[model samples]
Target: MSAVPNQAGSWSTLETPLSEPIMETLGLLGFDAMTPVQAGAIPLFMKNKDVVVEAVTGSGKTLAFVIPIIEKLTRREDPLKKHEIGALIITPTRELAQQIHSVFSTFIDDHPKKDQLTLGLFIGGTTTLAQDITTFNQSCPRILIGTPGRLEELLTRSQKIVNTKELEVLVMDEADRLLDMGFSQQLSRIIAQLPKQRRTGLFSATMTDAISELVRAGLRNPVRIVVKVEDLTSKGSVQRTPASLDINYIVCDPEQKLIQLVRLLQAELNDMEGARKFIVYFATCACVDYFYKLLKQIGDLKPFSLHSLHGQMDTKRRTATYTNFTQLPPAVPAVLLCTDVASRGLDIPDVDYVIQIDPPQDPKAFTHRCGRAARAGRKGKATVFLIRGREETYIEFLKLRKIPLERGYYRLEDGSVCDNVLKNDDAEDEKITTSEVEDASVAPFIATLRAIVKKDRDMHDRGMKAFVSWARAYSKHEASFIFRLKDVDLGRVATGYGLLKVQKCPN
Candidate 1:
């Protein structure tokens, strides 16, 4: 379905101003209406103006900058001649770089003259320097997406092969993160190598002092665009978070947080009409790991499987867990415990609920966590858990940030699900016990485990050893219980199905 805007300042509304080819590509991408950030920034960009956009994740910020770059790069005077690197997109992480490159590749794939254009991804941890140099020498892509460190290295080592003198556009995605990660000097060095006269864009979830400095030095008379949360509350507005999402908060005692989370998960898991897929956020990896273990030990919560994403885990384990949780069916309950790393630029579909165990350090982080759900206009729920005493502080912060949050009630120790919690709710001791908790059927749980291994097989041609390794690493159950079967030997069945080999597995 081609997007036809109903009013002015919409994507379909901008159709006449954009070239036919770009509009055709957008139609294929299913982008009918323009996101607020996109509508606010794209017109200025089309006129060769610099822009600094501060929009939360999943607010179409990517396309807000990407479309303009595409338009500028494709409008070259001589397409028949060897294409030069027209646009340079600098990202903070390898995953983000790959994601941005994938977005660019999608449009390029649909272009009429795709053979004349190329998109390159330069990031560390996957390829060697020699391989990168060879690719650069053979095909200096017309559009380049890469991390700051690797891009700087390539510019210094392969100076002759990689040219930026004619670079028409430059973009810094997640500029705040880059600055927070101490990439100021490296970003500066890379910028020093770029052409002085070019349209620039700086996009991030937040605007800190460091980001402001970057904007001052980087963009020229840039137009600043901020997509506020209150905009979503406006009637008939097409800006900010989708109206389908239910944004709420829950206040509890610090000591009772874990029990409160358990109760919420129990209610959601047992309720006939509740979301099955959930993403729970925490302040630290230790908290995530601790809570993941606690949930695994709770028999009542057995219906819901758990996955994790944090900086401490090995890259292989982290990637595997991400793939599993993302692929798991919504009917089979799954919860992904993660930190800020999973909050940005990572799109996980069908997320029914997003729970923040603690109030996020800032409003931008809260918005990104909520963005994990209610995507693509789908209805979802987001809840924040605040300690009793700090409720007022967080509430004040939200008010100052102009974030719209509704109070939500949850089942408390008093056996009543209510919205109000006193500042010192834990004055009396109440221990939560699971002794009487009933067991949910294991059919769905077992099937979810098998489904993960099956998806891994579909993605890679690995043998049984790999499956066992992943299962062992991912599941908290003892190896025997996780792989046990009533009729057929689980090992034999797996081997017969090409998911396992006859080698002795690790304990």
Candidate 2:
């Protein structure tokens, strides 16, 4: 079934009416209507049936499971003890887990029986295992949310501290990403310990064979719900991303990539009506680190709030950055430079644009990345920066998957690319003609980047590492036919990285 916007479905429309507290909380959260996934899956979950929900990101998959979990716990005939968990939600990343936990908190906090129900977050890096165990023992959270590794460890090593005999619902959020990240073994172990009669829901944006195997193993005669998005551009065609998302791609020389990005960001910052929150995706953690530093040094971007998030950062830093970015005021113009770690299952509010410095190696991730914007029927835009030539074919590759793309242009001002850029579908707009390497602003920007790497040994080392990691990641692209590493120009790629010089990466 395809997901309809909030208008078509409402909380009041559910067959088994939600508890009064749940209804009141939904009203407080401003959720006037149910999304398609919510409308479809909520009733099945309420009926105590296992569900496999495959929906687009930002289609309100969180609430589809969250509400049911709350409803089940609240209506339980046997009240759960403090340490006895009733529902367990396992997502792939800590950020996603945190987001889900927040949603649970929103409903739990407002419910009249909020005091009776408790919530716990057990992801790694935020706290030590001993600390988590202590909290679990003390608080006895009724609903537990965590990542697979920590949840597996907690369930396996400290069974006494983490009780699951009463576990009522088990959810694998972003189920496909869990398998893609090689967490199948952990998921299997976690599932084995849970009671077979418990409700199990596997929620993901894209369904894969591995997820099907997981469903077969974990769920019992589950009802499958696929919430597809209708493509507004073409009739009778389905889109993986939201209809409100405008996906565009920009083709530029390798050396001009950074200049193009800086100019685009500057343009966005200057546009009062444009997006204030931006997510810039880098190919690797090293790239995020290097670019985060590089972009911070640029004079024009200094006034805007710039932050970086990657998988390598310590738990506290990652949690802090995620919290900081999410809580930023709507009026503040902020940009989060991150890797694909920030891509899936994270609901950052009012994200105006998602800029991909490069396409992800995984094809499915493209949909997830764009889903960050244009979420929940809100207007959003995404543009990927691709190198000219063969990389341009990626556009067609995505088209084959029903992901449409439009040409993204570089907006220029006074003979150089400037703000108010990447507004597609305007044929009368003047195209940028300045040679990227020779452009007045771009030439100075590239020089400054090179000089920073040359003068600072640490910065220089970071650039080299980022370039090599990027190349290695590109070589392993799922669509290697298009993003072939050998077809790349090492010299120009190095120039694009602002590296002091190119050096062969040791195999």
In TM-score terms, which candidate is top? 2
lDDT score, candidate 1: 0.68
Candidate 2, residue 463: lDDT: 93
lDDT of 2 by residue, 1-507 (tens): 333343457798888999988888889879998888888889889999898988888988899999999889888888987567899999999888888888888888867888667888989776888888888888888888999998998888885677789999999999999999999999999998888879999898888899889888899998888887778768789878888899998877788788787778788777778788999999999999999998888887886799999999998899899889989998898999999998998899989999999899999999999889988889999999987667877887999998989877765434253333334644242333222334455567678889878888899889989999998898888999888887778888898888868978633
What is the TM-score of each predicted model, taking all chains together?
A: 0.74, 0.93
lDDT: which candidate is best?
2
CA lDDT of each prediction against the hidden true structure: 0.68, 0.85
- Which regions in candidate 1 have their CA more than 4 angstroms from the true location? 1-10, 19-21, 80-83, 231-244, 270-273, 329-332, 361-364, 390-392, 412-416, 419-507
lDDT of 1 by residue, 412-491 (tens): 54345754544443533222111111213223433443444456543223334333433343233222232222322335
Angstrom error of the Cα, residue 105, model 1: value is: 2.3
Q: What local lDDT does model 2 show for residue 203?
A: 90
